[model samples]
Target: MSIRFAIVGCGRISERHAQHISNVGELVAVCDIVREKAEGLAEKYGAKAYTDLDEMLRYEKEVEVVAICSPNGLHAAQTIAALQAEKHVICEKPMAINPYDCGEMIKAAERANRRLFVVKQNRFNPPVAAVKELIDAGKLGQIYSVHLSCYWNRHNAYYANSWKGTKALDGGTLYTQFSHFIDLLYWMFGDVKEVTAYTANYHHQGIIEFEDTGVVNLRFYNGTLGSVHYTVNSYQKNMEGSLTIFGEKGTVKIGGQYLNELEYQQIEGIEIKDLPPGNPPNQYGNYVGSMSNHDHVYANLVQVLTNNGIIATNGFEGLKTVEIIDKIYTAAKPL
Candidate 1:
């Protein structure tokens, strides 16, 4: 039997969710403040449309899972409400803007006895999967340090007439632009023990409320040292999103425009080969970068819901992602 899904935000990301939901399950309803956007997606998928999420939740009794594709700041409230309505939730990344809200969302899920999954689709990238396996199996012995780079362009036009750059809605470059990279850092290493950072609005001064570029240093709980350099000031398009690790036994770099390529490796005796190509990056009007791995995400959701399988990204993991980002932003000082 197909899982029944409903969407609470019919934005660009919602299209990806709807497409994957249709493949793995049925899209029973869609909700958005903009009537046109809601109706547009609903009509395309043969699902009911609504301008209010609460009303949709109340009426769409068959919706087993609610995907929260709304703006960053609204994720916690929307997700908590859906969980209270006795439906599972699949929230987009960063989970929530702050750790407090993320904690509340987790509490709501526990109280309601519902599942809360966060979308960290980059984890499904074949190269990422391979590297994770290597690290887990101790190939990267005593992982000493790691470096992350996110050089992506988000022209002024991309933020115009949308909620992409605002502090209240978008929650800064890390939340909207590079949370996946941060999550990968945590997933591979462990919790961040310390953070020191500096940020600036080099190019997007009047456009975005927060920094457009930043540098960070992290000390993971497992004694791994990490550094991150990120920016939306890359010339005209996304330049690179990569992670390089150095350890006692091996060195590996996962580099590409996205984390889709296993660029370099010098393991002790293991070789990563025959990695199947991954899905193309998601495109929104003109900008592109969010890896299109929602199919894997939805598939995992189904496996966990129906087969008692392990959730690829659970609520606690989602909360940790936010907690790390919160620490980074809190440590950040203007450069």
Candidate 2:
């Protein structure tokens, strides 16, 4: 049976979701406040376009799934409404502005008895998958510390159009770009016990009230300490998502997306001797290096719905991520 999908908020990323739904499930409806955006996507996907979600839900009876691609602030309310309407939900990242909203979304899903999946598509990258496998295989040994460096460049104009630069709306870099690293951190090292963070809008001289640079220190529940250095200012414009894990027996470094390339050093038996570092400037050489084909996440969502498999990033996971972000934001605020 084909799942019928309706997408809310026809924006930049919604196109990717639409392509996936068209390929896998039946693209039944498209809804956006902007009529032209809805109509454009509706025509492309052969789905009805609506300006109001209630109208779409009432009229388009076949829409079993609703993808919440609206602004960051609207995600929780929209997701809860969709679940209440008896449609499963796939919410975009930074699940909500805060943990309370995320919890409300999860509650709505549970009450409605529908599945709620959060789009943490970065984890789907091939290199990241490979790193997970390596860690699971005990190649990294008893992991202790992790260093995540995400320094990308997002121009001031990027946040000029929408609710992006505002704290009440977009929630800043910790909510936007560095969120991938936050999710990655949780993926690698389970729960966080404590977090101390500092944030500032140092680089971009804009009216928007949010941070463009943030440094976070985390203490994991398992006694693993980690640091995340995130900034939106980079002169070279190179995107780097790298992780270096230090373990009791050995160390493993996976640089770039999907962690496709690896460098590992192991110290044999209780000698207490340090093994030489694997490589200088260990560049996984663009491991699995290339942009991901669009619709990758949507296709995966289809599989999850059809197979009744566990949602790798479910509503609970989304809420937890938001909780962590909230903690960081709180710590960063002035005392």
Candidate 3:
């Protein structure tokens, strides 16, 4: 039986979820504050359309999974509500704007005995997966450090009269744009033990309430140090989103527009073989971002829901991502 799915937001990211969910799941309904957006997606999939989440969940009770593509800040509340409604949830990245909110969502999931999955699709990138395999195999011994860079452009036009530019909804660049990179750090390394950071709004000052540029220094529980330098201040387009790791025996670099390629590698006895091309990065009207692997995420979701498989990005993992971001933001003084 196909898992019945309903989307809570029909925004830009929902395009990815709607396009691929039909393969392994049935899109039974779509809900959005904007009725037109919900109707648009609903008509395409022949699903019911709703203007409110509670209305959809109340009437379209067959929905087995709630795929939340809502704004960053709304993820926790929406996810908890869906869980309380007895539906499994697959939330878009950042999980929530804060660690406490994420904790609440997780608690709700536990009480409802439902799964809470976070979408970290980049983990499905071939290079990323291969690198993870090496790390797990202990080929990269004593993983010393990691360096991450994310430089992209988000002009004033991108935020003009939009919820994205606000602190309450979008949070900041780290939440909206670089959360995936932050997640990758947690996924690869263990819990972060320490963090120091600084942030700035050099370009998008009045346009956005939070920083458009930031740098973070991290120390993982294993005593491995790491650093992240990210910005949405690139002039014309995205500059890079790359992650390089140095280990006792190997060094690897996963660099590309969206962590798509295995740019560099030097392992003692292991060879990085021919890797298949990865899914393309998401392209908005004028913006581009992390790899578009929602299909892979859906596949995993289907496996977990249908075959009782484990989630690659579970609630705890999602909470950790938010917690790390919270730590960084807390460490950074006013920009």
Q: Which of the numbered candidates is closest to the native, going by highest TM-score?
A: 1
Per-residue accuracy of model 2 over 1-335 as CA lDDT, tens digit each: 88889999998778877877778888889999999999999999998999998888888877889999888888988898899899989987789989999999999999999999888766765556656666676666777899887767666666667787887778777786667667877877788888898777777766567777778888899899998877777653546667788887666666653333444434334221232222122122221222343355666677788876666788888887888788888877432
Candidate 3 global CA lDDT score = 0.91
Best by lDDT: 1
What does candidate 3's lDDT look like per residue over 103-219, in tens digits? 899999999999999999889999999999899989999999999999888878889877897889999889999999889899999889999998888988778998989989999
The CA lDDT of each predicted structure is 0.93, 0.75, 0.91
Q: Give TM-scores for every candidate, taking all chains together and pairing residue i with residue i.
A: 0.99, 0.87, 0.98
How large is the C-alpha RMSD of every model relative to the true structure?
0.8, 5.8, 0.9
- Sort by TM-score, top down from the best: 1, 3, 2
Predicted structure 1: lDDT: 0.93
Which ranges in model 1 have alpha carbons more than 4 Å from their true place?
Answer: none
Clashing pairs in 2: 126-258, 127-258, 127-259, 127-260, 128-258, 128-259
- Supply the TM-score for candidate 2: 0.87
Cα lDDT of model 1 by residue, 1-335, tens digit: 78999999899999999998988899989999999999999999999999998899889888899999999989999999999999999999879999899999999999999999999999999999999999999988999999999989899999999889999999989999999999999899999999999999999888899999999999999999999999999999999999999999999999998888899999998899999989999988778876799999999999999999899999899888888988999999997
Question: How many collisions per candidate?
Answer: 0, 6, 0
**Winner of 2 and 3 under TM-score:** 3
Model 3: residues >4 Å from true position, as ranges?
none
- Compared with the true structure, the alpha-carbon lDDT of candidate 2 equals 0.75
